[model samples]
Target: MTQTFIPAVFYRGGSSKGLFFHARHCPPDHAVLERMLLSALGSPDPYGRQLDGMGGGTSSLSKAVIIGPPTHPDADVDYTFAQVAVDRPVVDWGANCGNLSSAVGPFAVDEGLVCAADGEALVRIHQVNTKKIIHARFPVRNGKAVTTGNATVDGVAGTGAPIALDFLDPGGTVTSGLLPTGQVIETIEIDGRAFDMSLVDASNPVAFVAANDVGLAGSEHPDTIETDRAVMALLDRLRRAAAVRMGLGQTPDSVGLANPKIAVVSAPATFVTLDGRTVEGAAQDIAIRMLSMERAHRAVTLTGAMCLAVACRIEGSLPHRLCSGHADMQAIRVAHPSGIVEAGATVFQRGNGWHVESGRVYRTARRLMQGEVAIAPFEGEGDR
Candidate 1:
């Protein structure tokens, strides 16, 4: 009844960590793959702590990455990310994680799945969920991977080499256009109150609203935000309303799969980050606090940054109010609880519609460890 152990790499890509699996080791069938991954990560536990499995009992720790040679024509590698819940043994594969995408290129090169020359290699990764292309620029010296550099991320400590990520065609990844609601901004009546909302799908779909209306200053730390039961109640109501309006679904208690993320925005204010570094509020466009999977994220989500960038580039909206007046390119210095992270997007006026060629973001990742991971024994007969 012993399950075969497979070699994998445990990496901390940006603020998130996950186990990267070689594509060949994963099941090809969708249902079988889901079952195997659930067992492998040790999910569905009522206690919420993945003590008996590899999951680290949080969204940041509970993750998985699958990569290999391209199955489609225009891609170099197929990258898939899974978010495992802490309390439940479920993997939400409906969206893409740009933070974890940083680890994939190096993992592929180390596994000999792809070849890199003596210098930098361009990794074209096709996200399976959104089918969007994430272009990663990696440094390779002497046929080995380089994890050290001069690039520094807000949440992570120290400085390392830079990995420039270009998110192309961020619009319409899941839906049909950049503005999922067919408008740049709209007023939504939530709980008998009118709130200005921007529904955009740059890399993922998000509904941006003002923080003050939600009774938040938008500068509080994650712990402070998490403890407020009233804040969570308002967020839940907004999220449910936004989900239904965005064509996601009409389930009040269970819109888990269709995530209509709720984001609160405010004028920037100086604060000490969790890492003890001080960030100036004047240097940022707007302060943002995005809720992920119905919880306050330790740091701002990567795709959340993309949505912010896209918002800043537009002409009229909550984010557009903070734009620097430059019509060509806009850079948003988003302040998260951990620290400040920046994402940039170039805007061009093409007659009536705006064109966002790509979104640029910087993140740091390190290979923490590499070895074989042994899963619990499976006694049932093989489906295949």
Candidate 2:
């Protein structure tokens, strides 16, 4: 009954925390790795609670990131993200983890994959899953990474140092074009009605729709939203339909890729945040809430926030309708379920069309533990 252990780091980056491992340390075989991850996270329970594993049994906690040497010339590290299902004992490699991305640079710097000076330095990371490059800017003092600053992100409780993240050419991260459909907005017929939607494939591909059309105020709590099984069912249908239209899948049920998230937006309105703080509509450009792995995110994902920023900057888009005319090509503030998150974008018009040059945001990361996870040797054997 001897168990084998794998080296891992349990760290909190932004609003989420997960187990992270260097890519080289993981097995190249799929079945073996999947089994190993299940034992590490403890899953396949019908109760939806992962009481026996490292997983907290939530979408945010059941995540893993694998970082290794980059395959691209300009990139410094290769990041592979996985979302392990708490109840399935299976890892879904179909999407990127935006929260964990904030830690890739620090991990690379700590692991000696990339070198930095005694001040602020830029670490280029190639998101291997999407083949996109992200410039992660972190502060360094005396040759070590510094994690102290005044910048505050809403989802996280305490204010710390800032990590400036610039996602270059998010439009082509997954494919070519900000609007994969080559249009800012399109009308889709679903359930015998026409819904205005925007399908964009930036850092993440997302289908943006109006909240009012979906019978929502865009200010509901995560628990309240998830409990409405009817709403969840409708969203699932919409997501599946959007997935097929975006060419990400052949059918609604096959829309499993976590990137190109699906979201609904609405004009800013007063709502009590997760922390119980009142968010004033006048102080925000737009109010939005997004779904992650088919559930409302407690706050918002960094990549999703990037997509929202891009949507806002573009004219004739749902996000643009919520703007107060203050957002420009450089910066825009979005109001999420947690509070407010500010994202930056580089854009310009070319040949009668608008293009997203890049998108940027700030996130924080910290290593919680460094150790190995043990598992039964029989697990993951010959698994496909």
Positional deviation of 348 in candidate 1, in angstroms? 3.0
**Root-mean-square deviation per candidate:** 2.4, 2.4
Model 2 weakest lDDT span, ten residues long:
375-384
**Candidate 1 residue 100 C-alpha distance from true site, Å:** 0.5
Which candidate number has the best lDDT? 2
TM-score of each: 0.92, 0.94
Model 2 quality (TM-score): 0.94
**Colliding pairs, model 1:** 43-89, 44-89, 148-161, 149-160, 149-161, 150-160, 151-160, 170-202
